[model samples]
Target: MTTPTHAHGHGHSHGHGIAPVSGRSLVTRLRSLMPLLGEHRRLIVVAYLAGVLHQLLLLTSSGIGAYVVARAAGGASLDQLTGWLIALGCLIVPLVVMSVADSTSAHVAAFRALADTRAKVFAAFERLSPGYMLERRSGDLGSAAVSDVEQIELFFAHTLSPLAVASTVPVATTVALCWFDWRLACVLVPVLLLLASVPAWLRRQAELHGHELRDSLGRMSADSTDTFQGLRELVNFGAHAQRLGLLRGQGARLAKAKSGHGRRGGIEYVATDTIALLGILAVLVLGARLVIAGDLDRSLFPVAVVLAAMAMLPVLKVTEVARELSMVASSADRITTLLDTPAPVSDLVSRAPAGPVVPHVRFDDVTFSYRGDQRPAVREVGFEIRPGETVALVGRSGAGKSTCANLLLRFWDVTAGSVSVGGHDVRDFPQEDLRRLMTLVPQDTFLFNTSLRDNIRLGRADASDDEVEAAARAAQAHEFIAALPEGYDTVAGELGALMSGGQRQRIAIARALLKDAPILVMDEAVSNLDAASEQAVGQAMEEARHGRTTLVIAHRLSTIRTADRIVVIVDGHVAETGTHEELLAAGGAYVELLASQLEGFVERAS
Candidate 1:
């Protein structure tokens, strides 16, 4: 069975643009979060309604106070005053209740939305290509995932419900004031509109500075993380002071950026407050004149003044959250960018292929390039491995050996041609199914910060303790593991820092052994091992290779001598292919590589 040529183009479109995400308008970017808001619509609606009720209670209290003052001055009965006081006292309990309910509901909804957003972001990270992730700084990505996502909570909790109250409360208060005197309502409406426009006028400046602040903070985070991860290297090279200086420089820039944005926000706050105060003052002066000229009733003058103050509260609320909205807009933009990015490899085929697992692999006229590279990393590369054969790929660094392995794993699709397994295009199988058929032991084994037993069990999650121990014995790791204080229960620490390089490599081999996939790819599997450990690992590989396909990527000649065939890769092309001795006898690239290694060894010895 052979895959048809058209299978290569089944779900991929070469004509689609593969550019980085572009910046969008603030409104458009923030609107992307509506789906998250819609998820908890009931909580949002309850919070908004509570906010409205809370504002209305305040307005009613103000109106009742105005009536009591007017009636007392006009010599009303003590009975009327007592009745008014009772009504005012009665509003307090529900007022406090509504206010608390509003705050609690909004905050709960915000946190829930945040949780969903982070989950989706994590899922997006999982779907994106490893190559794409490698191009970015891990710390910067962390900032987007953790810090940027946190910033959005302010918008959800404070801005969303308050925006609803701001829209409705002012109009309701204005209508109530009109029932007292149309003249006072006329004076306050235009002033309220001016207060609301203050934030809009400052929006562009806020957006510009907010974006700058977020970017500077992200850069600072990346720099700090990189410095810490490489602290050991810096100290060994006596470059700690220089690296510290660079870190301080990042900190200084971050401080400067934050200060600039803070200064502008402070100024906007002051301006909005001044406008709100002046609006209240205008209502007072205008209402007093109307009362004296006999155009307004004296008793209702205080009512108009108090209502005007109540009306401006919503506008003030809007202004208070306007700065936060600007800041959240920047955060929302970053998250949108991450979510919008296209996955480098699409898993279009969902079903597992129906056939026996042959373990044969083939690369047909494959070409690939890194995202920003001018030249292809691997050009017109092709290879074939028969069932149960062991093939070694020998090459210098950047010779596209690892790229070939990546293509086989379908970490990336071939830029041209196809990589097929068992006569089916790798793309025809789901990514999980394709990967399940093979196992990889990378040069730098990444052990989780977990027990030694659990790290080995990662390859086969359901493997029993006995099965795990058996795999460890096959890789010659059971001895060292058993010698530890807690044996298999010992923690590996970060990246297996608690263990020696050779021990880590053996554990990785044990993991691959436990997986027991039909196709095994070992990338410099013995490069970190000492002579004794290498011998043990070599025996393990020999035992594991029986009746299975194996691909070994190595620069060490001794490691490949036992391979059935050796293919020397030069400058992304297959330069020679034959048995180990045959390649050396041919006096080609493989022999030259061997000579170079020998020359280096001799030089170091001298």
Candidate 2:
């Protein structure tokens, strides 16, 4: 596989670094979501307008209350009071209607944006190399796909509309207060500015705390997944208590981080409320003095105080969402980090070769190294398989047997030299086209958590029931599947846990058989089978080998005797290649490997 490189133009020794450019500020991180928001701009616009109207009505209530109190004290007529009350009632009804409409539209738009984001994340996962994916913990990746995406809803549904309304309502409220008295408007402006700066002052702390919280949650999730997957092993080893203690420690750390985050938020909250209350007191004091000096009308004194208090309300609303904004910033940073990670192999080829498919496969002076490995897994290796020929690659463990197969499958581009099928370089063909030309049965077969029929159908999604049954029978999996209570419809639990290893292998073989590709690669296909099942699978493989180029990565000596030729790989190079009897006579790597296997078999019998 291509080694992973840092793509964000910087490195962090401790953690995933923030995005090189856009991740520096909360506003920029939030702005990254605009494309998703743009998808539903109509809804967003309606939601924003409705939110503005809702806040306007709410702020208007305070002015109306002040007006009523002033007029009532001035001995207004009953008809005038009744008329004012009726007008307030009419305003309240629309306020409730707009409030509901705003909430509904905002939530719908938020959920839609969240869904689109999740889809994009999933597509990115597909484009990333499997080798790169293996380095990430399943839980951490899952949290990025699930939890992080969900956290963004707060930004879309709650933060966005309120931010929009807060930006406008405070100005509108100030203008109205200015109409009554510019002096009161001037007093309120500084207090609003100070309140708005609180989040900025706490920015660094909030980000640090938010990062800690998200990391803790991700680690805890990973630990939980590992524990559950290994529950049987933990119980058998009598280490369940120890595992539980570790999880408890993780929980404690998460709680402590959450506590710290909340404490910081609490301090900000108290400061904001204190500042808001003081602004109101300042306004009341200023208004009373102006009234006594006849600089302000007595009738408008209550109005000025109430409007000043109301103006600060929007600022308070903005401050209220500041905590959630910090969390959104942290989540966005992680998501951007993932999106920025470079794929191990780029899919740059756009079209398949125009010529006919070539069954002949060649690896010319191939060399490869896994990321972070000190030595190449395979080096300067050269081999070729003719069309319609069967070749067995026999080697001891770590001798680069599977690595060769993986190179042929293009799981990793060779670091040196070329792998070609049918005269076209594997890299030249689109990945989909290259994969379509070959079928592989890996050593460890993976079965999805689905019905047995569905698992087999994965090989050819449109294959009919008859075709699936035929392939299963050829793979010698039909009998067991037929015996199940649900027959082919039986559910295979997670990772095919409900079936024995051999059974899972047969199902995988059946899947390959259904594909009916021109090139077949089998890596230890019979490794898990018992003697009888091995014989059956071997017979099926022998039949399937006809008129197809086959590469078998074999450890067992008996399985390769009938091959057209045997190539013995020793220390990542081909040491010998000949027919079975010819190799035994040569008495090199192949003979030695065979002798060791025979010795083991004899010891087991004894």
Best by TM-score: 1
lDDT tens digits by residue: candidate 2, 186-229 = 88889889988888888888888888888888888888989987
User: What is the Å distance of residue 47 in model 2 from its true position?
Assistant: 2.3
lDDT of 2: 0.83
Alpha-carbon runs more than 4 Å astray in model 1 = 1-23, 73-75, 528-533, 543-546
TM-score of each: 0.92, 0.91
lDDT (Cα atoms) of all candidates against the true structure: 0.83, 0.83
RMSD of candidate 2 to true structure, Å: 3.5
lDDT of 1 by residue, 15-61 (tens): 21122223566667677777767668689889999999999998898
Q: How far is candidate 1 from the true structure (C-alpha RMSD, Å)?
A: 4.5
